[model samples]
Target chain A: MAGAGMKDRQSRMSRPKRLRKTLKIPAIFFALSLAGLIWALLVDGSSDGLAALAAGSPLMALLWALLYRRQ
Target chain B: MSANMIKRMAWVHKWTSLICTIFLLMLCLTGLPLIFHDEIDDALNPSHWVPAHPDGAMLELDRILEIALQHRPDDVPIFMSFDTDRPVVNVTTGARPDVAATAMHFASFDRTSGDLVPPPDNGAAIMDFLLQIHTDLFLGLPGMLFLGAMGLIFLAAILSGILLYAPFMRKLDFGTVRASRSPRLKWLDYHNLLGVMTAAWVLVVGGTGVINTLAIPIIDFWKHTELADLIEPHGAPPSPVALHSLDDAMAKAKAAVSDMVLQFVAFPGASFSTDHHYAIYFHGKTPLTRQMTIPALIDARDGRFAGLRPMPWYVKTLALSQPLHFGDYGGLPLKIIWAVLDLITIIVLGSGLYLWLGKGGQRMDPAMEPLWQGPE
Candidate 1:
């Protein structure tokens, strides 16, 4: 079927994602998150404000992702 | 990865997320209000009551215990804890020394006058009700363990989600919304983005929650093993007819752990202590060591110092796990962040359900279904 041939072409276009590329930004966010979580626990007072911001990398990434390049 | 492998991961991701989605939603909803429970309680019950004798000499600990016992004539004393910021000491009494936490009655007394500190229970009942639902669903230990199992499943769903994410976004960039695409792809993209961003926090919260559910078992293990051995040399347990002065015992316990502040005291014959000694617990005033308690035992019969012991590593792990889960350690800012992340997680869960329901065909419900099977 002509439709079957098109489906085959589309499936062929589905390439496997590069592991390094996929994990690049997520890795950075994860490291920052871990550091921030520990920092909050190890100290207190005004530093806690800093710690919360650091732990909020994901939130930052999230904001950037949603608003990065609007169509 | 092979297409089949991706399909397998998808299978795992789908079912696990589907099974635990509802419970996770419940947890997130209940957990939102609980994060600021302290603030809510404070706002609801604005206290104007002060100590009876601000400048007068302090009331003896023994006298306070006596008054507490006199107030609850039929109940036996279990725990005595002091308020960190004020001159109030809380006494917890129950029908028996080894009763469950639910059965215990907690009342605060002014250290200056031995007068009962009244808490206008304005919104406290609501918070208590939410706590019960959040903790055990009112089913006690079994319910707690059941939630713990759910937490483990949630973790599985998270990890599997992460695994499947790599292949899902193979062609697309990070944070890709694909709003112009079909509804399924847009939601799928959103779910992946939110899932990855919120993974670490949810993992930490979920893991610590599992640890917390094991509290009763952990405490029981400590009591039956370490605590029992420590009290072994003191001979068989004996119920003291007239216990020695609690003030004297407190003084001895304080001297043993001079650097740490008093946390609480477990009376003799209590589950937290032997029938021979009063287990007086203390902790550092600093944020790091605040919850890590070191207990000093004092003989109840003659008020002798019975040595100080820092809690074993397991108990310390349990202690550290508490604040991580509660998000209470780093003050208000951290709590706000925790609340935001919790909301994001709720959205992620909802979107996941939406994506599945939109599959339309019943064929998609079983394993090896969904996106990968579209034309393969």
Candidate 2:
């Protein structure tokens, strides 16, 4: 239901309004970074690669904010 | 939040960040190379030497030690550590068991042939120099404690930054870099975005770095409290007697903790061992547990098996903080990411300084200007 509502909201919601609604993506990125750090610490082998990718979410966010929309 | 609250938070954020920015910059710079510590060692010291008898049966630990002692006739072993992936045993020796770090000498011997294996590292003195400065500014405990205090102030700045972030970001979207806007806004947005994006990582590294700075005191506390208590039950230590066989004691310790791999052996009278026991330390077989170790005590006199002494909670906390702060748990990719993040942190810090020096306060929105403006 929430996902459906978010989609319905997305149809008319501007990107800034969408972002300000709940600080959704940034919060998710934060969670991912923290989890990735702990995940990398806890496991080994190829999972480390996965963990690194997860931890690099902030870097991705940085790039996205730089390249995407400009006002 | 009220204007009064925002002003107070701004004042705090300004001062705290201003104070620790230089030191934190130094930390980030030095920490970049440290993240690739293993790779650096491997690159600097290209080791082409292989085991003399790779498949042949390895020599007894006792003979290896005897050969090591014979090589350094005047010195005694302080600590013995093993190489995980190679057939090498390293013995650190000093004139006496209790000696300062500078007075100690280290040598490695191949376990199979008992031949002397030259220690790795052609030269990395500059790296060590950077690491030392990063750790304590070469002021020893005082420097460490001072850095820890700086870390505390840095965290306060982060908190204030967060409180202040909400007001600036109220209208602006998350990570909205106004690069085409005036220089100040561009930098301000840059600072905010980078700071908030890297905030989680910064907190982790900063918190763990603070914990790491308290290592000496924590270990000393453990030694005096829990470690002392553990050894007390064994009664007052007896006079010096003929030392028992190390191989036998190792065998007993192996039998005691068969699942763990040997990390090192701290002999009696050494800093890490009691005066009457050979503390054989073992780390678990798995990756995470490998960071932690438990030591089994063997009576130095008769080599009787004593119970295992697991590190207390605080020591474990320190052990775990190491990899978290180092960003070494993952591989080279993680190190590269760590370096990039660190470099971006430098920009965030540098731009913050730039913003503060200019009309940052005077240029604030009219109402908020009075709140942030200081004597320029």
Candidate 3:
């Protein structure tokens, strides 16, 4: 009975931890989208290297999130 | 969230998505080729003839106008535009100054030699076909307005989908596609995942597209209100007099705005200019400012500078929306990103269609159990 209780406790604890991990990728993507939009608005040349990085971040994040799911 | 609220949101999402999916799909497919329009044009019509004036000593604007007129004596000049990289001037002429665009004759002239440049076969017919279908479905203003309405519905669908996302994802982890489940559930996850990921891009592009569709009306309003007053002092438009030296007018316009380069000129009696003025439009050298134009109105009768007309906020917004919607401002890499995002959006749209159809016309409910709740 003690072993079953311990296992139940461990499973409950891991649920929130997995939820937090799942939240991380989306949070990063949200930040990247905001930054990219602002940079595109304020910067003079959006075609340059830095602007490309900023503008492409959302897609890149999506790619990373997809890959993370596969793992 | 409450189940009632989730149901309401799902209803909105379903209806809006269903209404706009076909039109949105058409836009994406046509937009894919438009993203690289310049490169495609260049590749198809390679410029073989070098500029006659290698030293960049361009001929007088008046002379070029005269040559253009000689080619089509019956036609009157409507607009004249300059080429940035080459010593060539493009002139548009028609039977009347206010002729419709379909009736206009366009030709290029060598700026230095006054010789007619051999026109390149740019696959114009195919490009026009794609552009017309993408822009207005060839229905003109009504088509544009209809598409604008569709764009609004698209925006509504995106917002409603976002609302449903919270409830749908409450029990599931983010980005979790249940590949082992039935195909419907698998596509549902993809639709949600890609939808949320591309939300910002869709919002901006979709919103800007709506703004762009209003361009003709906005320009008409500006002309009727602002430009009408500017030309009031000159009285009713008089009979067509021989226009003053375009070269002199161009020089004066250049003097007025030393930093800006001449982009185009609207001839007198054209929609863009007063009956007595040559509307010389100038644009800044930088990428951001290049999208905007400042008009320097010159009296065609006297070749004198009048004044620079200030653009209202709405007009400025329209100007800004052009580049933002095109995604060409950020160079090739940004364009590629736009294309990729565009393709992803297609998948999202396709998956949404599959889910709705795959359910055999049943009402979609957020609280519904997964299609494959047990082992497949």
Residue pairs with colliding backbones in model 2 are none
Arranged by lDDT with the best first, the candidates are 1, 2, 3
RMSD of 1: 4.3
Which lDDT tens digits does candidate 3 get at residues A1-71? 75367436544655446445545565576567656654664466533657767666777766765777531
- Which 10-residue window of candidate 2 chain A scores lowest in summed lDDT? A15-24
DockQ for candidate 3: 0.29
Over 4 Å off, model 2: A1-22, B96-103, B230-242, B360-362, B365-376
What digit string (tens of lDDT, one per residue) describes model 1 on residues B1-376?
6667877877888888888899889999999999999999889889898999998888998889989989898987889998888899999999878886778888999999999999658887788888888889889899999999888888889998988877666445678786766666677788889899888888889999999988878877887777776667676554533788889989888877778888899998787788788999998888889979888888888887878877898898899889999999888988998999999999999999998888777444232233474323
Residue B3's C-alpha lDDT in candidate 3? 59
- Model 3 C-alpha lDDT per residue in residues B144-212, reported as the tens digit of each score: 899999999999999998766654543455676766666767777788888887887888788999998
- DockQ score for model 2: 0.32
Error of 1 at A55 (Å): 1.2
Give the top-scoring candidate (DockQ).
Answer: 1
TM-score of every candidate relative to the true structure: 0.91, 0.88, 0.88
User: What fraction of native interface contacts is shared by candidate 3?
Assistant: 0.30
Clash pairs, model 3 backbone: A46-B330, A47-B330
Badly placed stretches (over 4 Å) of model 1 are A1-17, A69-71, B231-241, B362-376
